[model samples]
Target: MYALVDCNHFFVSCERLFRPDLRNHPVCVLSNNDGCVVSLSHEAKILGIKRGVPLFQIADIVKKNNIAIFSSNYLLYSGISERVMKIITDTAKNVDVYSIDEAFIDLRNYEKKELVPLMRLLAEKIKKWVGIPVSIGVAPTKTLAKVAAHYAKKYKGYKQVCCIDDEQKRVKALSTFDIADVWGIGRQFSKKLTSFGVNTAYDFTQKKEFWVQKHFTIMGVRAWKELQGIPTINTTEINRKQSICTSRSFGATVTDIESLKESIAHFTAMSAQKLRKQNSIANIISVFILTDRFSKQEEHYYHTRSMALPVGTNDTAELILYAHQLLTELYKRGKAYKKSGVILSGIVPNSSVQQNMFDNLKNREKRSLLNKVVDNINSKSGLNSVKYAAQISTDKKWTTKTSFKSPDYLTNINELFEVH
Candidate 1:
């Protein structure tokens, strides 16, 4: 059997993790730049406040209703996610982290009598220890496990546990759920299914495999099989990332080439550290810059440029040089730039490559060793221990807005909040 565990109102839950007083109150976490609501608590949802509603539009409503708002604190959220997943992994024989707030675990080894209680215990432990409430669903397949999780969350006093081990319960759950609620059914497919009088999970499951495959795509076929209690997907262990990129919007629009170069260099250094963390090297580098469309100015621009390396490298200096070259080509002098980013692509595992044959530099080995030493020092001491000339400015105009942001709580000393 597979068990799917999903956290309830994840971002809101993360906020509440540190401030339990926020429970039973309307709370939301805003998106980057505090532009819109990205996550909302159940209380906020009950107030008819929908996700993605712009913050400015809902500011009056939020203030009048005494709603609590927080800026996105990814450092805290990611740290909490890692802790919660570790708890689930310790309990389950096998666990696959489906997302930041959801995971799938294999529970076939446990007896039916032992499964639900253990799942309930696990959920309670996570809530007690990690300050996140979780809903769990267990079934013969992953899709049904997802369905079970939805039901587990819909009604209270299920103790956050829903199990579909028996045929009767499975049939009843399928019959009550809408066709669109099924795991992989998109709106268009759901509409087509409704036309065929298949408006629920039961209706979709009742169709033959051949019919599902003929009318729908492979995804549909997989969902169909999963609904019929067949395991259509297998769990794979999560591996380290191949590439990482960090990009952000400017605090104010910038039009100068020097300021743009500074932003690109900072982002490039961050991306290089990320690459070094994965013990990988990039074969290509890309830089992108764009202007704000909302600026009332008629001249809006977006451009990206990428260059391939003569050989794979993870050297921050070399990466920044190439990034600056790309930025120079892409940046126009008079146009206002709102955002910029650097990406290191074509990443390969450290063990995948052989020494280059074409390069004739006698000090190539020395350069590689020096790069590794620089990475180690920067990683221990904070980012940019070794700075680039372009990023020498003490004040950065392109920083993100995080006025209402909570304490990092897990990372950063200066940003930590304490209640005296």
Candidate 2:
């Protein structure tokens, strides 16, 4: 059996953790630059506030309803997610982290009678310990477990845990589950399924296997089989991201090369930190800059440059130097650039990084050790505590707007929450 654990209203829950008064109120968390609604509380949803709607579009409603709003605080969210996942991992040793707020537990070894009770206890423990409510769903397959999770989160009658251990329960759940809400079935497939008069999970399962295989290929077949109480989806213990890109739109447009360089330098350093965290290195570095597409004051400009490194590296200094070089080639004077980013690709495991025959091995080892020490310090302190000189600039035009961001209570010592 597979049990899926999903955090309920994760971002809003994190915000409510420090601000207990937010409970029973309409609350929401905005996306980058306070662009759109990303997470919302139950009260906000009850008010018909949809996720991903532009904040400006709902300005009147927000003011009328007195909804509590917050800017995206990724640092705080990640810290709380780590604590929640840690408790889960400690309890369910065999676990697959599907996303920041979700994990799958393998229960093949446990007896059928113990499945629901075990996960119910886990849900209670997580709520009491982390102050974040979770929904756990158990079934014979991962896809089915996702369906059960939906019901567990939707109706409070389940007590935050649901299990589909028999054919009868599975059929009843699948009958009402929307095809679009099923795992692996995105909007595009849902539209196609609805066109064929297949509107529910059970309707999808009624399709012939050959027809599904012919239309959707292996991925669709996997979802189809998994929905029919067959375990076909394979979850690896560690899945390395294919590429990492760090970029952001500035709070205000930048025109100078120095300011853009500082932004790129900061982005490169962040990307390098992520690469080192995954024990991987990149062979390709790409830099891109853009002007405001909607700005009538200047011609829209978007250009990117990519270069192959002599050797794959996760060293921050090397990445920043290369990123700066790319930016120099791509930057056009007086463009009024609005955004910039650094991308690292062709990533490979650190152990598989082949050394150049004429490389300076000694210097490489020294740089590697330097990165480790710097990372150690930054991890103990806050990010960018030991940043390179290139990342520091007197001009702050490139910084993004975070007018409503909450405190970093878990990660930053200076921003710790105080109890009065």
Candidate 3:
């Protein structure tokens, strides 16, 4: 059996973990730069505050309804997600994280345990420990498990855990479910399916092999089979990401090569850290710097460069040097770059990296050790406790405006939530 566990209004719930008074209140969490609503509580939905609605458009409504708004705090969300997943992992025998806010728990070992009751217990444990609510959907396959989760969320009778162990229940669940809302069917597929009179999840499974193949190829066929309670998709295994990128729009535009170098260096350092975290090494480093497209006075320009490393590495210093070289090659005299970022690709597991016998790169062991030390210091003392000299001295500066961001309560000691 497969069980999908999904957090309810993940971002809003993360904020409400600390602010208990906000429970059952109209609350919405915004996207980057607090631009649009990304997550909203059930109470907020009742007030007709839709997700993705721009904050400016809803200003009057927020004021009239006394809605509580918050900036997207990824640091807080990640911390809370970790704590919530720990509780889930402790309950289930095997698990696969589907997303930051959802995970699939393998329930093969727990046949002896009363399934729905056990799931309810797990849900309650997570709520009690993490101060966040979760809905669990159990079924014969991963796709159906996800459908069960959706049903559990929409209605209150499931008690936060919905199980579809019988074919009759499965049919009923799929009959009412829109084809578009199925796990793998995206917007494009939904439109095509709708045109073909496939309105419900059940309607999709009724299509011929030729029709499914022509529309979605093998992938849609997999979704079709999974809906029929046959597990075509492998839920137990995990696939490594093909590439990892770390880039952000600056709080302010930059004008000089030295400052752009600083931003790219920091981004490179961050990308390297991510590579090391995933036990991966990258052979290609790509950098891009762009000017504000909205600026009427300044001519628009986007500069991008990619170079293969002499040897694949997850070392921050090596990546910073490569990033600096790329920026030097791409930087113009006075472009007024608004955004810059670094992308590391051609990633392979660190252990799988084969050394080039003809190429001689020295001090690799020492560099790895130094990078590990810096990562450790930042992890323990807080990020940016230690940084490269180039990063420390760059006169070019940019800062994010996160006035409404909550404290990193779980990750940083000084920012820990306190009882007054």
- The lDDT leader among the candidates is 2
Candidate 2, residue 77: lDDT? 85
How does each model score on TM-score? 0.83, 0.94, 0.91
C-alpha positional error of residue 376 in candidate 2 after TM-score superposition, expressed in Å = 4.4
**Pick by TM-score: 1 or 3, better one:** 3
Q: Model 1: residues >4 Å from true position, as ranges?
A: 186-198, 235-246, 265-284, 309-321, 343-356, 359-393, 415-417
User: Could you tell me which residue pairs clash in candidate 1?
Assistant: none
lDDT of 3 by residue, 1-420 (tens): 889999999999999999988987899998866778999999988888898899999999899999998988887787678788888888777888777899998887777358899999989998988888999999989999999999899889999999999989999999999999998888998999999899999999888777788878677898998999998887432345568888877767888787787788888888898788778899999999999999998889997999998788998888898899888899888777778999999998888777877656677888888989998887665567799887775354654446578888877778899999
User: What lDDT would each prediction earn against the true structure?
Assistant: 0.85, 0.91, 0.86
- Any residue pairs clashing in model 2, and if so which? none
lDDT of 2 by residue, 1-420 (tens): 999999999999999999999889999999878989999999999999999999999999999999999999987887788788999999987998878899999999999999888999999999999999999999999999999999999999999999998999999999999999988889998898899999999999999999898778577788899999999887652347679999999989999999999999999999999899889999999999999999988778999999999889999999899899999999888789889999999999999887888754458889999999999987666577788999998777998888999988977788999999
For model 1, residues 367-404, the per-residue Cα lDDT tens digits are: 77887788766544444666768777776778778778
Candidate 3 global CA lDDT score: 0.86
RMSD of 1: 3.9
Task: Give per-residue lDDT, candidate 2, residue 111.
Answer: 90
Candidates 1 and 3, the one with greater lDDT: 3
lDDT of 2: 0.91
